[model samples]
Target: MSEWVDVHFQALETCGKRARSAANMLTVEDVFQDSSAKKPADAAQASMFGDLSHSGALAGKVNDVWSALKEELGTGRSRLQGVEKAIDQVETNLRKATKAATV
Candidate 1:
């Protein structure tokens, strides 16, 4: 029926919107801190200290961003799969209805 088709389409559109929002959030980096080097070290010890500090901070930020992006991607994938399954169910139902009408 047209009603059933409309329902399925609406559900699919909602899922798609959610997935896109999640993807956009995952791509954004404003929440993540910048890990740029502050200044050049004058001495060897200072250089080593700066290197260690910068590397550690950068690594932590990178890890956090990676984890957040991964979670978002997983959520998007799950939503997409749900939408696919819903569409498949609708198609199956439509086919069955058509077959019944024919018979």
Candidate 2:
């Protein structure tokens, strides 16, 4: 009965590791720098719409996207933590059940 539990625990460990890796893939600094937004946004606005206004609007939009991505990544990381905790509980219960059966 507990053989499948061992396999499931290993699978959860792998899934949690992959989720943590995905979560670390993005950061706030990876999006915007400390300098004025106009320079960074200039490249984007120029490519999208030639000679567009460097009014920082495009920068705000880009930042919004990155912020949302980072938030989602944070959620994913938290979920992985939850999965690890679940594995712990499952392992504990399986051990208890086995011990009780032998008794």
Candidate 3:
């Protein structure tokens, strides 16, 4: 029993693939494109509101959140892939050890 190694390879592979797929779904620019709201906000301020500071601040915060999320998604994908690779290596090593013991 001690010699047997139990690993759910399919689950790990699926998790890694899903992580990569999720990260690939959104670009950094799509997450938080600077200058995207700038023109519109500036125009609105120039035309109507003399003070758009609060609105600008809110937008900034939203952008910050999006940027952080985008970064985390990439990081998560890398970490998931690393975990999968590590698990695969462990399984391979276990198999080799078992085969050698049998021989």
Of the candidates shown, which would achieve the greatest lDDT relative to the real structure?
2
Worst 10 residues of 3 by lDDT: 38-47
Q: What tens digits encode model 1's per-residue C-alpha lDDT throughout 1-103?
A: 4677668767756765665555454432433435464322331233344657576566566567766766776676666666656766766677688668868
**lDDT score, candidate 1, position 20:** 56
* C-alpha lDDT score of every prediction, in listed order: 0.58, 0.62, 0.57
Which tens-of-lDDT digit does each residue in 1-103 have in candidate 2? 4687678767766775665565454344543455455223333333464456874677568767766776876776677667666766766776788678878
Candidate 3 residues lying further than 4 Å off, grouped into runs, are: 1-52
Candidate 2, pairs of clashing residues: none
Model 3 pairs whose backbones collide = none
Clash number by candidate, in order: 0, 0, 0
- Pairs clashing within candidate 1: none
Model 2, runs deviating above 4 Å: 1-51
Ranking the candidates on lDDT from highest down gives 2, 1, 3
> In model 1, where do residues sit more than 4 Å from their true spots?
1-55
Per-residue lDDT tens digits for candidate 3, residues 36-58, read: 55222222222243456577666
